[model samples]
Every structure is written in C-alpha cells, then in structure tokens.
Target: MGATINLLVMASMPIAKVLLLAAIGSFLGLDHVNILGEDARHHLNKVVFYVFNPALVTSTLAKTITFESFLTLWFMPVNIFITYLLGSILGWVLIKITKAPRHLKGLIIGACSAGNLGKLPLIIVPAMCREKGSPFGDVDVCQSYGLAYASLSMALGNFYMWLYTYNIIRIFSRDVIDDANHPEVGDESFGNNTEFLLKPTEYSLMTPNNKIPMSSKFQQLLSQFSGKINLKPLFSPSTIGVLVGFMIGLIPPLRKLLIGNDAPLHVIQDSAYMLGDATIPTITLILGANLLLGLKGSQIQFRIVIGIVATRYILLPLLGILIIRGAIRGGILKCDPLFQFILLLQYAVPPAMNISTMTELFGNGQSEYSVILLWTYGLAAVALTLWSTIFLWLVAS
Candidate 1:
C-alpha cells in the first residue's frame, strides 16, 4: 500500500508540474498575442528548429548509442506506423458510420494519430526514467534515446500532417470547383482550364481566366519553396553553438583539439545541455499559449472531441499492441520486451502539435484539431498518471 501510494504521488507530481507551468505561463500573459509578440514566438521556434533541436539529436544519438541500443529503437517506428495505419482506418470508419462529410475524415485521422510526443513526454518520460533508473541512467544513453525519439516523432508527425493537409485541400478545392460549375450559380463561364491550388505559404492561390500572371512569378516561386524553408539555418547563433557542442561530443579528434584530453568538456556540454533543457519548456509554453488562443469562442463540438479522444487513446494503442505482439509472436520482429513497451507508450501518447498548424494550412477543420488537441492532452495526462502509478506499484511489488 505504501509503495502504491508513493508511486501514485510520484506519477501525479509530473502532471502537477506541467499544470503549474502552464498556469504560470497563462498568468504571465504569454497566452495573449498582443503582449507576447509574434516575433518572440518565431525566434523561439527558430532556435528550437535549427540549433537546440538538431544539436540535442546529434549529441544524444552519438553518446548513448550502441549497435544493440540502435536496434532496439526500431520498435518505436514500427509501432508508430501500425498505430497510424489502424487509427486512419478506424477514423474513416467512424466518419462513414456517422455519415459525416468526407472532408472531415483527414482531420479526424490526423488528430487521432499525430501523438504529441515532443511536447508532453519531454516532461513525463524524464521523470519516469529518473524514478525507475531504467535505460536512461547514463546521460549519453538518455540523450541518445531522447533525440532518436524526438526525431522519429517529429518526422512522422510532420509527414502525416502534410498528407492530411493535402487531402483536405483537395476536398475543399473540389467543392469550390463544383460550386463554380453549377448551372444554378449562373457563372459556369469561369474559364475551363482555371484551377485553384492551395499552397502552404499563400493558403489558396486562384488562377483565373486560365492564365498565369507573369508578374506573380516571384510569388509562385515563394509558394513552391515555402514549405522547404528552414529559416535561420547557417548563421543562427544557437545552431552554431549546438553544432560545436555536437562536434565535440561525437568526434574524438575535434574533442582533443578543442577541449584537450585532460578535461571532459563538461563546460561546453553543460551549456549545450542547458539549452537543450530549454527546448521542451519553451515548446510546452508555446503549446499552452496556442491552446488558449484556440479556445477563444471556438465552437468545438463535444462529439468530435470524444471521437478524437477515443480514436487516439483507445483504438490506436489497442491496435498497436495487437499488431506489435502478433509480429513478435510470428518472429517478424526481434526486439526485446522493453523496446516493445516503449513502442506501445509512444502509440499511447496524444495528438501531435503540428495538427493544428496543418488544419490552418489546409483551411479545413482547424477548430476541430485545436479542440481535439486540448482535450486529448488533458485526458492523456490523467491516463498517464493513473497508468504509471499502477505500473510502478506492480514493479515495486
């Protein structure tokens, strides 16, 4: 009973911490767009994307990795793929069963499968690892696994978000075209070859009278490259700092040249580590702010929230477990039980952060994505707390 209570408290502590941090950020007027300023948010993201994030990845991966450790990480991606596939199918079925419009299907699936691994787990997992003292003990290993997990989570989430956005855009464009071509609309002569394409940069750009404007060449080029732009790449101070740290960590020759063999390069490493630590906190604060912004008179239907939560928390995890277990039993996957559990936990996480961004880009179901994200994270925090407590108690016993 004592162990159970301790574990319960331990589990609840992290959730409380997250809630407190979010509350503090809220009270500080971070949620108010006018006060925080958009430029600061952009700069924060730029730091995370170009400098701190990639350095965190390379340093972590380089230090913690063995052949076996690298091999074990494959389980995460497999389970993520399985969960995504099953969640997509289940979301589609739900859409059809409810007789909902087809355009909503992409949003539903995207929300269910995106798994906010970066934002939430940054708080949850380290605490759990510290308590359990599992594979995360060696600072190198912890960094490596964290980076690998982040890379996988972000890449998969980004890919799916893009895919769903594309589908939503296609659906919306089809409707617009249908409307324009309708006989009762009385404007069937809107030009035969003209088309409406939604680009990530410009949202929707319309080509009218079946002619591309020569003056808009620069705009068209910008649209083509906007999604590919990784701003603040070469000269960003944070990027340079992290890269220098990563080089020191990974390359023995560089380490010898820079810091020498006497010392362990703790100063540089610690500085980079401190910056790395800031990445997650900054991300969580941004997410909290985004959620608050989204909640302003946003009419998110409760039914949609319920559906998204059910799909994300229940269906995806179930499907992931079954698929992974079946694969293991069939000798298709050679990963150990610990790796399998990690994969399962990854699937169990809530919607990704990028879903809201994608919804805005596609101009379809942004509100639904925002509502689902807030509710899903709130529910996920509760579920994780309860589940971790139970697991810890079982282990202790």
Candidate 2:
C-alpha cells in the first residue's frame, strides 16, 4: 500500500507540471490576451521544430549515445513505426464504422498514428526520474540517459510524423477539396508535379495500355514513387541533426573534439544544450494554446473525436506493452528497466502537435484536429498517469 501510494504520488507530480504549463498556454491563447494565439503558436512551433529540437537532439545524442547504445536501442525506431502502423489500422476501421467525411479520413488516421512522442516524453521522463520514489535511481544519471532517449524519440518521431502523417493529410485534402468534392482538377493545376503521383492508376486503371512494356512501365512507377517521397524530408534539419549526432558519437576523433571534458570544441555542445533547454516549456505552451481553440467551439464530429481517443489512449498502449514484452522475451532488448519503461511510454502520450500544423497547411480539418488534440491532451493528465504507474510497476516488479 505504501509503495503504491508513493508511485501514484510520483506520477501525479509530473501530471501537474504538464497541466499547469498547458493552462498557462491556454490563458495566453485567449483572444483578450492574444499572447500565444494561433499565429504565435505556429511561429513558436517552427522555432521548436527547426531550432530548439535539433539543438537538443544533437547535443543529447552527442553526450549520451555510444556505439553500444545504438545496438541496445535498435528496437526503438521499429517500435515507433509499429505504433504508427497499428494506430493507422485502428483509424481506418473507425472511419469506416463512423462513415467519416473524405476530407477528414487522413486527419483521423494521422492523429491515431503519431503519439506526442517527443515533447511529452522529454518532460515526463526527466520529471519522473527526478521524483523521490523514482525506480530509475541516481537522478543525474537517469536524467542524462532519459534525455538522450527522449531526444532520439523526438528526432525519429519527426521523421515518421512529417513523412507519413503530413502527406496523408495532404493527399486526403486533394481528394476532398479538388478531386471528388470540388470538381475534377486537371493534372496541370498541381504546381509541384505531384498530382500525377496521387493518381498513379488514373492512366493505367482508366485505360488499359497494352503498348507499354512491363520493364519500362515498372521504371515509370519507380520514378513516380521517388518523386512523391522527395528528398526534402529526409534532409530536414532535425533528421540531419540525428545523423550528425551519430557521426560525432561514433567517430573517436570527432567525439574527442566536441564531447566530454578536456575537449577543444566543448563550448559548442554547451551552447546547443542551453538552447535545447527552452524546447519543453515552449512546446507545452503551444500545445495548450492549440487545445484552447478546440475547446471553445469545435465543428468536428463526436464519433471522430471519440474514435481517435480510443485508438491512441487504449489500443496503442496495450499494443505497446505486448510488443515491448515480446521483444524482451525474444532477447531483442536489454534488461534495462528504464529503457523498457521509455519504450512503453511511447504508446501512451497525446497525438503529435505537428499534426495540427499539417492540418492547417492543407486547409482541411484544422478545427477538427484541434478538437481532437483538446480532448486527448485534456485526458492525458489522467491517462498518462495511469499508464505511467502501470509501466513503472510492471518494470519494477
């Protein structure tokens, strides 16, 4: 009983921190205050994405990642990808059952697919580690390693979230706004030459062309796939930071120059660390600001909202436990409890904030996305605390 109470109390403190920051954000976003308004939050998000996040990921990865860490944590990226995959499958089912609108299909799928892997975990892990009853032992050591995990989570999360969710929303918008709902759009209207990628079957499906050779047609399909993915996301600053961090960590001479005591360029790491420190508060505030938009008056469907919450909070977390435990039983993961705890927490957090940005960019379901974020974040206080307790107790036991 005493231990249970201690763990619950430990869990509650971090919940309070997140809630308090979110409240402050909501207040700032009010029309009267207009301090952290939508435009303001959008710009703040850009700063977090382009500046603070990369700095944090680069610095943390440099300081904590080693060749051994890579080998031990190989399951993470795959695990995160699986989380997205499962959420997508769940979302598709929800959409079918709910009879959702065409424009909103991608939004539902994206919301369920991308957890708030980066921002929430970064704050939650360190705060949990810092608690008195913390199972991870040694505050400084726990925080150092925890931050590294969170940073890499953020980096990889950005990669998947942007590449997959962003495009999903964009494609759905084209379907609803231009293709079916609006009017048949000419392929020439698409400025980026991306329209052809969307309807790869329009040529073949609409008209069977026997004159096309199999190998030559296969080459055309390959080029279209390549064009759609584009190299831009792979070369995003955050992704680049991960690559650079890995290079610095893996190479001895580079590590000697920038990392550890007695290093020549140690000051550069300090600069990045200082900048990265600003990421959490700013993101949490932006999250709150965005949710405020949803709470006041939202136009989204009730079933859509409920579907997302169920998929993210209940289904994905359950799936996370099974996958991580199997990895453990299969000897795929190390016997580090803290590491296991981090992996489980990935499935339990709120939807990624970038989903909101993507909705706004595509001019489809932005308000609905905000509403989904509102409730998910509102419930995160309770849901995350419960999951954290279970995860902590499970690993500790």
The best candidate by lDDT is 2
Per-model CA lDDT versus the true structure: 0.57, 0.83
lDDT of 2 by residue, 1-397 (tens): 9898888888888889989998998899999999997688778878887899889899999988899888887888998999999989999999889988777888888988988888899999999998997989899999999998988888889889878887777766765665554354542323334334435564553326435556655776676555545346556778888988888888889999999778999999999999999988988888778887786656778988888888888999998999888988898887697889889999998898888777777788877877888788888999999999889888888
Error of 1 at 265 (Å): 8.6
Candidate 1 local distance difference test against the native: 0.57
RMSD of every prediction: 8.2, 3.9
lDDT of model 1 at position 134: 43
Model 1 agreement with the true structure over 210-273: per-residue lDDT tens digits: 4556556556656534543333223434334334444554566655543433555646545555
Error of 2 at 115 (Å): 1.0
Clashing pairs in 2: none
Query: Against the true structure, what is each candidate's TM-score?
Result: 0.69, 0.90
